[model samples]
Target: MAGVEETEQVKGATREDTQAADREPETLYGISGSPGIVVGRAVVLRPRSDDLVRYRLEKEAIQAEQERFQEAVDQAEQELKDLRSKFEGDLSDTLTIMDSHIRMLRDRMILDQTANLIEQKQINAEWALSRALYLVKKKFDHIADEYIRDRFADVEYVVNLLQEQLSEHGQQFPTGFAEPVIVVSEDFTPADTVRMQSEKVLGFLTEKGGTTSHTAIVARSLGLPAVVGVENITERCRTGDMIILDGYDGRVCLSPTMDQQKLYQEYDRQHRAFSEELSWYIHLASETLDGLRVRLSANIEIPNEIEGVTYYGADGIGLFRSEFGYFQQKHLPDEETLFSVYQDLVIALDPQPVTIRTLDVGGDKLAIQLPGNKFKALHERNPALGLRSIRLSLREKTLFVTQLRALLRASAFGRLRILLPLISLLSELKQVQEIIGQVMMDLTDEGVPFDPDIEIGIMVEVPSAVTMADVLAAEVDFFSIGTNDLIQYSLAIDRGNEYVAKMYDPLHPAVLRMISRTVEAGHAQGIEVALCGEMAGDVFMAPVLLGLGLDELSMRPSAIPHVKRLLRHSTSRRLTDLAKQILKCGDGMETRALLDCYLASNAGEWRERS
Candidate 1:
């Protein structure tokens, strides 16, 4: 209402046309960083570009310039330490990110390289620091994994801190908004996001960042509505401009009319009420009207997400992506660091099992400092199909062994499952089992404590793996279908490619058949089969997955409650029947329509009951 103006007269216009013409809001779209909706004033945080001056220093001034760089590094390190201390009891994910930032600040790549460049190139500290950041960016640019590659944002944050320290123009967090406001910036660092007071900050809009960036991670952890990767949001938005941030659809609307404002307000109210209602199912068992029980678990990447798992009443962690710790550091993490992280995760969920996925990234993504320089970075044309996941582990035995040792050690704390990724052949599973055996043997010889009979599993992702699921199922303890990759590889459609992205469908007949085959194979072996994919999080797909006889559904934390409620309200027998009909569909479109109809009919029944 504050930003709205009176409607203007239009000749021969209907009431709807007059209402629509009251205000024509400009909308911007981006990647959803988190899920929610809010309307607030825009607070644009423009970057300070004037401080980053690039100029050569005289020979006599080089010593001072090098010293200045070190001073800046020391200050940046101290600032990160202070920030880390501030969030000591806060989210563990925030602290982990802070620790990574502190490590980056002191890493030789930033600290030594910047100082070295100042002395060698005889340039100002700002210029030399920028050069070091350029080198770091160049290295990260070649990383094939988008999640790992997005970590460049962390490095950029560290560099920006050093730059600010050198120029003595440190940016302050925008404050003193009378009302909650949406913060728009070129990009947000994890520190900036973590430091934001949720009561004052309605959401976030950024010009640069992906969902995997640390900034986005913090935002999601905070339960804030955020839309990242919006081009020129800071440039276009001005302070006090009314903004509508829709995290669900990744949309931002500027200067909404009275009607538009009322619509979104109702949407926000319903969303809040629905979220509150979902909490009622948290304490209830994830079972259908029939007596069939299903394990509703969470797929988490960081330890702090442990909070979400417990809050959402998940059975346990279904897929713990173990690659984040490895990619966050300047060098490969040793067994001790790896064990500490894993041990914390296991200890936190003592009775509840934590399934840890082994390093699933490709060799091309491991550009970090490897011991002895033995592991050379492969420049594969298509890294996804190249030496990655299980293949990379086998080739780099030592790397794989170290991780296995750490995981085995952590298993001593609580229920732990080791998941190997991309096992296309029986031989791959056999080789990994052999290495795991050797690690167990060594630990035995050393009189180290471990779970000797720890369960092992494989991510049935590749098409070959699906074909050989029965063979692999016999060897492994369980099967976790990685439908994200399964759909991509099965359809030969690169989900990242705009041209073929629409073709990459989880509801495709082949994909559902593949899931059915994997479930059947796992059932034949008498092992649990779980789906830990984007599809698993989808409420509509929950019935289909249940019908396919999946023992578990592992997805993001926020999605757990919705899926749980769906599971509890519906009958498994009905879901199974629906799945049977859907599997008969010819294509994804038809499958979707049938699923939609089923959901609509069910919703109508639910409405009548209410």
Candidate 2:
């Protein structure tokens, strides 16, 4: 935290700075939060933390200052309401979050507490307000559940908005663009990104964030090029400077030379052309030239992502991450709430099968009720390999049973399947099956209607699951490879740790062999094998997955069209040959080279256009 530039870093494109630079054409490195290329003039955003002049208010000025605070609150509430109105049903999660902020603004606790602080301490409104929020955040911090505690960030964001409103220094994004421009910031919330999507913003560069940040997720959803965690970017560049952003490589160049600008422009053009070509396959089914069909599905964290599913014409919802519901709410959702969501999703994506993954909470994601209410909070040194996913679910039967009943009840409405997460052993699969059988019997006894023949599957993530895929395949109806976790667990690398992220490779010989083995084992038992993870969404790996004879590939809904395009342009036989050659590679680098060669040789149109 010491080396960091500041806390709560959020700035936007500002007017041109007159100061001279120490060096021209400087390059900064960051994580590729989103993928694309853009050449544009830099617009330095107003600093997120402007110097606040905190001063004690005389007792006589307290009432007037309180009125000023109320006015700021009213303005912020109205802004949020207006923004919330702009989004529709498909963005229900964001809308819900916005609604929460509005409610917070209206909450008497915050207002009354701040007013008391102002009257008692004879402090300025800003100081009193900051103290009030700190007290509230302290309460949040004491919450044993990490998911609930992390909501403090939301509170911090709300406080920032109010402070900006009161100071009359809030920056509104430009609605029009004379030419494309890059928006550099220290950070952006999901709401910020959504608003920017309506403007002429070409890409995003931030001093803080990661792949799983909400800003990153929103950027990916909108298909914008973004780079995050570029430390001290604001110190190096200014508004109106020529900039080249290579999102594919996570590089930002300031005051780029003409030759470099031209090179990036061509790269940008190629990226756009490729995206345009992918759009042509939005309506087409995912199939190779040899007529082998592949089921292309979507992975969703919230119910709202169905918009992308409908937009891309995905075959179905393959991985509905049910744990997000737990994270979003203060308390565990009741059976009815879960049932309603699952039912609505099935109705929305009707006819197409929906594989709802049972709550896969733990390891960077904590359940709201599990740790504090049902089980003791864990302090494990290695929770990734500790009690998580099915392990946690089994230990908390009431929680698991409630979700199972909700899922079973919802299954009556549409083509729904239950997929267990992080399964590692035949015994775990057997125990889960036994519990499902008992739940189904109870439901029947109570005359509760559900899909009597609903299929059950398990995620093949742990190395043990892959090793025993043949045995596990015999028990479950299907297998969905959670490649993100599979790669991490197999390679013993923390994917979230930027220091070692490069070592987390899905194309590693061990990982691919596990996948190939899983597919073979599942197919041998006449069970469908699907991939529902980040790897499934990657275009470079789509053909390799297909070549390995996967029945389905599930990824972010935004990516389905591109994968479909790649599939449409390829042949199953050619992909099989490529896979065979890749399987023989000894390391990830060799495997990557083989894949690159295959794509370059086969996708001649892309090559020529580039």
Candidate 3:
């Protein structure tokens, strides 16, 4: 079949005539999330493992095959390099992740390992390469953390270069579909996402990956609409299945008729107009009609997320989780490496305060290097109640000191604050301070540079932190309640456990009481309190938080402008009164009712509220 660019035009056809032609009724349409048409033959990229040595071969043929294998690796690497150079601006740091894998594949260690296997055992190059890759794959799979485990895909990519068998037949892009090619894959790598051409390719539908997956990230970056985490996507989708992918709602329609396609086209036009209208708020501030100030910042785990800070116009970074560096990392980064990452961030942001949360791991966020026997024997069945956060620091005092030293050193580069997670008792804060003082003294003796007066705060995630707020508030510089965890603990429901999530409520009276008391404790002691959890980013909760007398709020970087707009209409006095009234409410519904009234009242003003 001829590609779209090569299609024989209908007699005397104009551009309008081309688009107006009735889409073949057989065409399938997912919601057209990404709006470009791809006209390429489908080339499936997959990870398939095999026993290479099973292929019996002569020595000379094996030698020839080894050279072929090496050449393929070299060619694949060059192709990756060419792609990177071509897309340098939009995808600068992205290809670097892939390049690392290429480097490893071409590294001496892998080459030597493969050669040793080939010479030591009577195996062909493909066999040797396959053996080595499987070993490497196992090493990555052994990682307990999901993030690191995902890296195994990179390993499989380069290895498959040596053993992949691809056939391109009737896989060419469909001319009869409503648009162009749709990717129906079990999964997509970041590399696949980058190679996707905006003009030729329509959106992608993957069988796996949630909103945070790399596929979603690249799809959003490319302005292509996409639907992910769709079970049985591949089964329902054929090369020419008429499909529509509604990115706005994460829904996809398979095999729609011409009438259905027309309706979707109209829907797409409307949705695009609505999105454009909403985008105007990007440069706008988050102030409400009244005169009140509320801080809006981002929660970031990746250092590459500096774009999120500027893109969203965040007031500052509320939470820069150090756990990503510690947990996803295979080995503990030395003080110099840690300092370099922090220092680069500090210098880049300059005066904006970056609240560095010292490694919050051991259970849900456990690092690889943490001792095995110690983590299990001493750890809790519920790590939420186990040796994590401030307590883990106390246990691994040396690691804590190393991290503290890095934070201090980075502070000299810019405004830096420390946030300690899971500080249920005053003793944890006192112990942390003692360690800091020692590090400061050691730095002083060693003549290292760091701001000794960097403000340190506690994450009010535990019931004890809220219950003993007055006492804990006295010793800490500030407090930021982590409502995601606080709600879980207070309501006795694990958020991750879907069966119990329905019981989780941010508006719960106990949760509200904890937040209000923590805020009161901090303000009474002449300190500031902020909410930096998922709740902080909730527009509905913004007014409730303000009413609770909270001084600052932080959330996803994308949420800043909307929350800021919500705040502009609020005032400390009005919110304070609301907080007082909430204190008198009987249950979570009462709090929800108060929030509903305020939301309904201000719903008209914030053009893109919530």
Candidate 4:
């Protein structure tokens, strides 16, 4: 909370005039949610809760309260739509993020629960909103996937906006800024990021968020510097305090010295330039020095993300997360809706093959959406290892059939592949194949046009799948190794849990061995192997994966150029030798040491241009 001391004395100010500047400077650290750098005056914005009054509503007034809630939701949706429309051309990424928030605003689960509570409890709209939010948070709290759990932030932000509107306080940002200022808040949703873009906000500092948070993702897309989870930034500095937001390192330096400001300014300049330089690799091939070509693809979440894939010159969409449709919609998307979305994506990619994974949700994700009154509580003590993915689909035949039927119908439009998620045992894969055959037979009998030769693949995430990779590879057309879940299951460490995140290592000898085994087995069967996981995007691990003979690598679109750039400068012979040595190592630290040594020796070539 201390302020930085001025290195130079002011021309006319006395010692009393510089009392605030005399305090020692403090540097707060957090996760680098978005990468860039900026120095600006800090504007601490806190949500207004003063006008939130709680009073019981009479039975006759319940209808009015419900209508009031609807009005507030509508107002919030309009504000979001207007804000999203401002960024059209180069900021399409931001638009997609805003779409998610808009969907959250219209979620039937939230609206119905809030309205029901208002009618049954005879409480104020605010009270009912709080109760509904509590229900959503309760479900998220039990989620095993950390990324999915972060979605709860969207619910909180949407409810907050609705409450602000209903209270008639609306919302306000600090005004009269003489210059661009860094906006600091307890949290910033995607909507907040959009709002900041309309103002003179240079960057942002948040007390709570993660790298995968929608706010952070939008910040990166906009090239805005942002650091989140900095703990008590609002209390540390007042509005207009000079601050340096080091988004690359996730450091917030309050009241920086004159010298520090200049150094950061230069760093910021180089960072922007480096980012531009990486864009040059967008149209280049991902080929090693030995002339081996590796397929680089994009792991997309939404249909809109296809634009990014084309811009980045990705070979195709390696992983289309179909579950996102379920998450974004109020109820389940019908077969027609699903088919249309898939059709669009495949048509956009055209010649490049699109691999679509089926609906992969269980426990925390799907159970939360089921009506509490209709369905019994769907509980799982450990959702990650419980009935999920292929297992869940097998149990719920109709849900699985609808998705398969839609996928089959869409296959006629473009090159398509079906990917099964979280497949552990051979039996699970076989069960899925049986269902796929039945669907194909039904379509055949009905004279519906569909692609019968659509390549079927399985996601090798669970350890059992890795152990039985040879047999599983024979059962499927290909294998896509999901290293994130594999690492978690292999090491028995939940990366989502902060306490044990340190133990979650993808470079663990066991994990690498599983990858190597899977790739070899798939290749032995003349089937291609791809990796669609966090590790695939990580340039530092690119050499190892390539050397392990991965046929394809799929990642977020933004990461494609960096990974391709790294591959272009690398030699397969050198990488293969290093990987061989790494495989001989006993532990992850040893393997990491080998990798670091290689990178250090070849820094001149491996490092990206500025």
Among these predictions, the greatest TM-score belongs to 4
Root-mean-square deviation (CA) per prediction: 5.7, 5.7, 6.3, 4.1
TM-score of 4: 0.92
Error of 2 at 565 (Å): 2.7
Q: Against the unseen true structure, what C-alpha lDDT does each candidate score?
A: 0.82, 0.79, 0.67, 0.82
lDDT by residue (1-610, candidate 3, tens digit) is 1122223331112233333234443333333233333221221222222323455556667566566666666766776677677777775446545556566566543566676676667576667777887766654432333344444555565555444421122122222333355556666665667776533456777766656555565676667667666766665444444466667666666555557667777887886675565466566665545655666778887777888787877777889988767643435678988999899888877787888898887545543334343443553455556677778889888788889899899999899999998888777778888888899999999999889788999999989888898888889888989897788778888665668868888888888888888888999999989898888888787777877777778887767766765676566676677778877888888888987886787567544543
What is the clash count of model 4? 0
Q: Write the per-residue lDDT of candidate 2 for residues 1-610, one digit (tens) a residue.
A: 0011211121323334432454477888998888998887665654655555678888799899889889989998898888878876545646766777787676544677888887888888788888898887654443333334446656666777788677755665444544566877666666677787677788978887766566676687677889988988877766666678888788999888889989888988888887787777888878876798999999887787787788898999989988878755545789999999999999998899999999887665543334244544564556667778999899888889999999999999999999999998788888898899999999999999999899999999889999899999998899999987888878888766769988878889998999999999999999999999789999888878889999999998878987887887778888899889889999989988888888888778644533
Candidate 2: list runs displaced more than 4 Å: 1-23, 31-39, 46-75, 86-97, 100-156, 162-181, 194-204, 216-226, 246-250, 259-263, 368-372, 605-610
Better of 1 and 2 by lDDT: 1
Off by over 4 Å in 3: 1-79, 96-179, 257-285, 327-330, 369-382, 569-597, 607-610
lDDT of each residue in 199-282, candidate 1, tens digit only:
378898998988788888888877888999998887677665678999987888887876887898888888888888888888
lDDT of 1 at 74: 87
Model 1 misplaced regions, further than 4 Å: 1-23, 49-52, 142-144, 168-170, 198-200, 363-372, 607-610
TM-score of model number 1: 0.90
